[model samples]
Target: MNLEETYRSLGLSDAEYARVRELLGRTPNFLELSLFSVMWSEHCGYKNSRPLLGRFPSEGGRVLQGPGENAGVVEVGEGWALAFKVESHNHPSAVEPYQGAATGVGGIIRDILAMGARPVAVLDSLRFGDPADGRVRYLFREVVRGIGGYGNPVGVPTVGGEVEFAPAYTGNPLVNAMCVGLLRVEDLMRSRAVGVGNRVILLGARTGRDGIHGATFASDELSGESEARRPNVQVGDPFAGKVLIEACLELRRRDLLVALQDLGAAGITSSASEMAAKGGVGIEIETDRVPLREGGMEPWEVMISESQERMLAVVEPERVEEVLKVAARYGLGAAVVGRVADHGELRVLCGGEVAGSVPAEYLADAPAYEREVVEPEYLKEAQRLDVEEIPVPGDFNAVLLRMLSHPNLCSRRSVWEQYDYQVRTNTVVGPGADAAVMRIKGTKLGYAVVTDGRGKWCYLDPEGGGAATVAEAYRNLSCVGAEPVALTNCLNFGSPEKPAVYYQLARSIEGMSRACEALGTPVVSGNVSLYNETSGGAVYPTPVVGMVGVLEDVSCHATPGFGREGDVVAVVGASGRASLAGSEYLEIVHGRVAGRPPEPDLALEKECADRVRRLIAEGLVDTAHDISSGGLAVALAEMAIAGGVGVEVEVGSGRRPDVELFGEAGGQILIAVPGERWDEVREALAGVPWQIIGRTGGGGLKIGGFVDLKLEELRGAYGRDLFAEETG
Candidate 1:
């Protein structure tokens, strides 16, 4: 191929080529060009997002390891550390749902394992188009199946997650996976290749042509011609993933590995180069030495192919044989592909000939671009809707039932049942709660995790939606009596090349940053998935926040259920006032996704969350649930359903009945306290905003004179099989 053709095939612009030549002081060879292409691609380089991501606060007292590692690690007390992260597989999932979603799980599990932690649980945050469309239904079904298929065999419980549907995702669906693991703080591992003579070992699976240029592929937008990119999607093997996890932990136990890294996105090129650059050392890899699934593969393909279930480790030269034995016992491929060098250049040898050599820093650090941001014109139209224009239901009882039955508000039992959530016996609280709580074996400490997002809210007002998303996750953790510690996010946005999309990205990050500061939760690790637009259109700027909090005593945790018949139900922090703008009621009932979302008051949010957490920890409250989406009515309904009981509440009728019952406001929580402890609970919550609104004993839910329904009636509407119509 001619020089220009070669450059284009490598996904490099003429300007980038010139930069590479100037840096190298000479023309680069074929292998060097290929390495530069994958490493500098938007997926690996964070070219468009690096500057924005810097806005996040990434340090805290409890943080042991922050963003520059495989995963963020936080001290969880009792000599244990938690490692966790969330990443996106959007592009691949849209093209090939099953394999794409499956590998996303496999990839994240390895990330935790690389830190010498035993992965305990996996959660997912998914988005799809209107389920009424045949293609959207198919994509949704396969993505869920793929997540369960991979996670179940790997032995990690699929605990809890969130899913949303919207028209923006009709052509580009999103599948983001998060994994959490535990390990002794002393056993934590780093990804730097520190020792100059350490052996570079490639473990698990053979290299293949599949997923070639996957990083570059992810950096581009999807068009009608994206079908041809199917080969770039990596196929996953969960059984292999299981075995690899076991072998890696065993290796760590034996103290055999000096450093390790998971082979994701850019495959060997990224792993090997990042390891070298981080340690200020060099690496030499023989392309021919890499185990290949297919013969006659070119050197560049072997270097960049993102084969699944693979890891690269820096092993002590003396203990290489022992490490190989452990890998062999697990039936994994272990090959000594190279060694760390004192020289600071990455050298590639093809068929015993030096094919390429370049400075490791040049490949690892891609140049960042500050894209221009212009306010989206559609925002003006989206913000113009008046809540008064939308009609409120005349019969409040029927409206509550309809809202409960809506797909977005309905129970997800059908989906969670397919997961092996009870496995490993460490799950203290599994799916169906505000957050999944898992006990650390042999300790009183536990960790709580929750994944949340609001796509329609974000689409209408990116800033408020972004702040609200973080606040929601924080409140969920607080409801469970856990102190918010740190967070990992997966930011999915449209192409950055468009000024309008860039504005959303910038404003959302600003909002998240502000909320994180107000809530005192640092962002330790995250992934950015850009170019999530197709010919159909761009998706709502969806930012999925996965938060981790620590519970000092596992026994003190709370659930969203009425604990006793005579318990008094109270609304804490703020009353639920209906703001119909960008609400589910407006979207599902009126067929429009417009208007400003509820304004998030960060100070009030923090005060309310702190009050709720204190009440639970002090054992003054029996049940706690946050008010979101469908508002106070829905929160009360969910608490009753989980407890299999009923409640009698009185709405003050001081405002519109609908606003009092269904306003989508933040900074409010529903709490249940024993009748005997009413005085004590009230005193402890003094100086905090709260109102005793109801009692938990009854056979039917009574909302004053507005609505009353049997407990079973509420359950029947909320618990119906969600996908039964389509599946049958």
Candidate 2:
């Protein structure tokens, strides 16, 4: 191939190649070029998103470690720290759903492990096309199986997550996985490769050709021929991953390492270079020393293999044998492939001859493009919807049934049941709840986490969609009575090179930043995945936010379920702001995906969540659920189905029944309290809008005593089988 063809094929632009040459002061060899290709790609380097991502609020006193780390760590009281991060395996999962998603789980687990934390739980945020399409069905099934396949064996509980469906995701489905871990503050480990003479050890699975160009593969958009790139998707061994987690923790417990980094994305190239760059030093790797799974692998292939279940750690030379012994105990491959150096560049040596040499900082810091941003013209039409022009259904009962059966609003028991969510025995609240709560052993501390986002909302109004996502997460944590502390996100979007896509990315961050700042929940660590386009079109901009909260006492927590009869159900926070715009009710019943999503009131959201959290903590509420997706009606239905108890209440207005009952809005939470204690609960939430909407009791769901459905019927519709068949 010609030089330009070579550069373009490597996923490098002409200007990027020229810049590389300038930095190197000469032409580079095949190995050096390959290193730059993967490291500088959007997957490894935040080349396209780094500048835009800075708009997030990322600082707070509780943030022990914020952005630019293996994973963000937060102080969760009692000297316990939580390290968590979310990453997207979109392109890979689209190509090879099983292994792509399985390996994705393995990748994030190691990120927490690298922080010297024991991965405690896993949460996934998924978006797919219409499940009626066989291709979408197959993708959903395999992706869930892959997640359970990896997380179950790896022993991390797949606690809680959210899933939504839309036509825009038909070809470009999104699979964002999050892993949260816990460690003592003193045990936190940084990724920097410090100490010049420390030996860099490669531990766990042997390097393989299965994931050769995985990083570069994830850097671009997919096409009809994308399936042919299956080889670029990593093959994972969760058995190895589970062992590596235990072994690495053992190493940390023994205090045998100076630093640790997981081998993800570009594998050794990224781990080694990022480690060296972070420490302001260098690394000299011997490709021949790395253990390979196959024979006849070239040095360049070995250097940037994107192998799964591997880690690089800097150990004192004197303790090298001890570290190897720990690996041997776990029956993992161990090799001393490199060493920290004072040279300030990552030097690759093959057969004792220099193959590639580049400054570590050069590979770790790719060119950040502040792309031109322009509001999408199509959005003007897409965001325009008249609620008054829409027809209101005569039978609200039938509408409620359809909404319950809608794929986006239906129950996820079939999906989450496949996961061993109780594996670690720390899960106090798992799948059915608004968020997952895990207890800190031997302490009163409880860590609550939830993942939330809506691609359709972002597609309608990126800024509003972004703010709404954060607000939902904050509300979820508050509903469960946890103080939302910090958040990590996975920003999934189409090519940022397009002004429209860049605008979405930029505005979404702005909205999320505002919400985070207002809610006192700062962004910690996150991953931005771009180029999620295919033949069908680009998926909606989905910035999945995973927020983590802390509860002072695990025993005092409220779930989204009715506990007793005659408990009064009340509408709390935000007044008369429900909009049919960008709602599940609008899409399912109206057959349209237009309308500007209701912009979130960040200040009101904070006030509402804070009040709800206080109510739960003070034992004032028996149940709490935030209104989202299908709005107040659907939220009430979910609570009824979960508790096997029904609600009888008056909720709606003179406006269209559909708009008042099923309209989507943020900063509003549905709460249940004893009929006698309603006065006290109302007094506590006096500042926020609080009204008696209904009472919890009976065998039927009755709204204003008009729209009514049997409890068993609601359950039947909500639990409908989603994957009974697959067309793909």
Candidate 3:
């Protein structure tokens, strides 16, 4: 059975069935329906997305928990863990970008806090249509400001992430916010509303019309006009979020709560049902007892409302008052809204009337649906074309600058700068660096993280794209002087019913496995989102990859930004004529996107990365950055801006702009070595594809074969025009 049929038998009324049926001709089968519930659910599904989410990496070890739970977890060790997860607010964002994206961040943070961890960082991955689209441009501007507004005030470092523009997302853009927290293994909190007689407390914001029926709202497609969905998009107050984090962590420290869950998505309904089911217990919620910001809400409205900055806690009966005191300390609302029962039913009552009841197990454990696999006809279409036969640009420099200035390749500094990346102060290497690095307080160790995805490439060649995504993440860590230890991923794809989607997923998985095996990086946690399809079409296959590496010395890491004038710039690894078939540069200039990205020779990549690490440690390299995305030109410009210096380089090839500058090449590093140590650095990296592209000088970026532009101009190209002229 497929996804459509399962809903048909759900005993829906003709109208409701027709609505579900008419949403499209397809009805998932029983199993597909179950899987659909899990995958499409606010917890599992990307329904509003049934489009646009095909851009994330969903595999790797340092991962403690992959998708499919309250949150995803990665190993952060000495017997510690970091739980993190990224979820979309497309529908909500469409309704209210500020509150939508803010609460999205707040919600993910609570997921970590509930796991008995202290959130240390937040990352948001965003997408919008071409800024030329007024509505999208407005939404994009507001969303960025909103995410920054919330994350900044709350003190969680908004580290590394990306922004992209594509017409496919015009109608319903995606905003995925991820939060990661630190915890000792022994302190991990589990959500199980166990222990009969435990009081269910609602703390944080008072319930209101805000975010009512968010789950049901999310379980549908966004038709662009989201007036009706406005109430379902929760309002956020990061100040309130900050207090809640402190209160909860304090409560946990005092052992005042038995179990806890964030009131997100389905709000009380989901938290209660899931917690009850997880603990093999039942819950009886009294709606009248729920504190409300406004009066006269219906029982269901109170039960399912997703008001932001709130949490549901199953407190030890004896410690309820103690936990209440913590909320009081934070000046937050606190109320006993329900109680845990030995019976396994999730019951709700209001004004002495039984409003509704259901088996906790049914609500919590939505059936997991396995999908039917069908291959798309496109793979065969792609296979028939000879990659070498594609047209090559006569001038690579023009292509390099075009790609460097492409919205996707441009500097994300504009977006990240608005965010207070240095807020927590633990941030050792903030945004604009290869990976975001943070120091472990009181410890000599440091952590490095980065998120990478190439949706178009993944769409064109899943295996290569997936492998490259992982390799790119590892390379990012290495460039920052950290050794990648583990990985976590979020797999975003479209309807899996089509063999083509399944093929993309399977091939990508193969790529991940092969790359991990070669690099010795293990998969620790992950999440998979499917059914991201819309009436228009499915989103490009996207696998967002998140990686974490460790560095013994926090001070030794490197960033892509320019360091100092007169510093020698050297390119490590072989320079090849990159195939521009599916290049972002090609797409921006030539109006086409297809073909494979540059493939990494794993053996060669490992050797080169190790040598760079050694050189950094030997103090021979002043600064280093990885060559990726927009290739050497972008890399050079980034280094120049970061160091607040200028550079001049000359490649051996007469064709300066060729693959060396614009290609999405991997396993390449640009190092800034002191002129005095240039000889030593060259000798240290002997036998590698290393070359002196140029030296830092002139206070502007000068790519011999490309247009010369001031460092400020190059930075402006990446930051200013990437968005539409008006918006910028």
Q: Which ten residues in a row have the lowest lDDT in candidate 2?
A: 719-728
Per-residue alpha-carbon lDDT of model 1 for 553-651, expressed as tens digits? 888889998768988998887664458778787776778877788778889889988988988888887599998988778888999999987899998
* Candidate with maximal TM-score: 2
Candidate 1, superposed: residue stretches over 4 Å from native: 726-728
Query: Using TM-score as the measure, what is the rank order of every candidate, best first?
Result: 2, 1, 3
The CA root-mean-square deviation of candidate 2, after full C-alpha superposition on the true structure, stands at 1.3
Which of candidates 2 and 3 reaches a greater TM-score? 2
Instruction: Tell me the tens digit of each residue's lDDT in model 2 across 38-126.
Output: 99999988898998787888899899999999899999998999999999999999978888789889999999999999999999999
Q: Which scores better on lDDT, 1 or 3?
A: 1
Misplaced by over 4 Å in model 3 are: 1-69, 72-81, 224-227, 351-355, 379-401, 497-499, 513-533, 565-568, 603-607, 650-657, 675-694, 698-716, 719-728
